[model samples]
Target: MDVIERFCNIYIDICQISPDDLESIYAKDVVFVDPITTHRGIDAVKHYFSNLLTQAESCKFDIADVFHCDGNNTARTQVTHIVNWTMHLTLKGNNKHITLDGTTQLNVVDDRVAYHKDYYDLGEMVYEHVPILGFVIKKIKGKLAS
Candidate 1:
């Protein structure tokens, strides 16, 4: 399967993803970034995911769309893939689930992801889930929308 296909399969059930699974889709020198932080190298990425998965009661990704930019044969380095997805996450000790929409850009080299960046609303994914913070964030959003 192609890199994007492999990525989708691995992320669809993030809670079950193992270090070996991450290795399959990412290069040894992979750089991964998300709303929270950036991790350089495959080992760092694996460590990040290990902690994240441990804190998550359940996590799932639903792919909404995928756009591929294939650079001309002359510039193999221009190839990039963008994937839009929605994530459903339930943190440990919290029965409530958070659904957040996000997009990921993947730079594939040699059929493995070398650079991965994710864009998502931190307020929706994290801040809004906090007890006092959720109320304040919602109030601020409501005020801003008016």
Candidate 2:
């Protein structure tokens, strides 16, 4: 399959919640970097998603745009994530609901993903969710604003 087609297949498989399909898209030694942690190898990558799926609900991804260059074997996807619609995030021991929007850059080789980097605001994901934490962070921001 072509690079673009390969990417689409991988995306569809993921949307189907088949983490094992990563084997077709990720190289034997892949590096995945995100706001949470850095993972190496396909198994580690699968584990990361496994954990996230367990904690988050809905977990739908809306692809806003995809910018790809077949020559460079690289692509960038702007996406919006809606998580936990009916459920709430447990923050420091409290339940909170949140949504996130972010971009992901993928480096591909041999039509398989090699290095993946995810960009997003941690505050919008974590601090903004918890009531007490969000309030404290907001108050702290006031002092740093000047």
Measured by lDDT, the strongest candidate is: 1
For model 1, the run of ten residues with the poorest summed lDDT = 70-79
Q: lDDT tens string, model 2, 12-38?
A: 324347677667777778888889889
* Alpha carbon lDDT of each predicted model: 0.88, 0.62
- lDDT (Cα, tens digit) per residue for candidate 1, span 91-146: 89867788999999888888899889899999998888888989999999999999
* C-alpha lDDT (0 to 100) for residue 131 of candidate 1: 89
Task: Return the lDDT, model 1, position 73.
Answer: 49
Candidate 2 regions off by >4 Å? Answer: 1-15, 69-96, 139-146
- Lowest summed lDDT across 10 adjacent residues in model 2 is found at 78-87
Structure candidate 2, residue pairs in collision: 89-96
lDDT of model 1, residue 84: 96
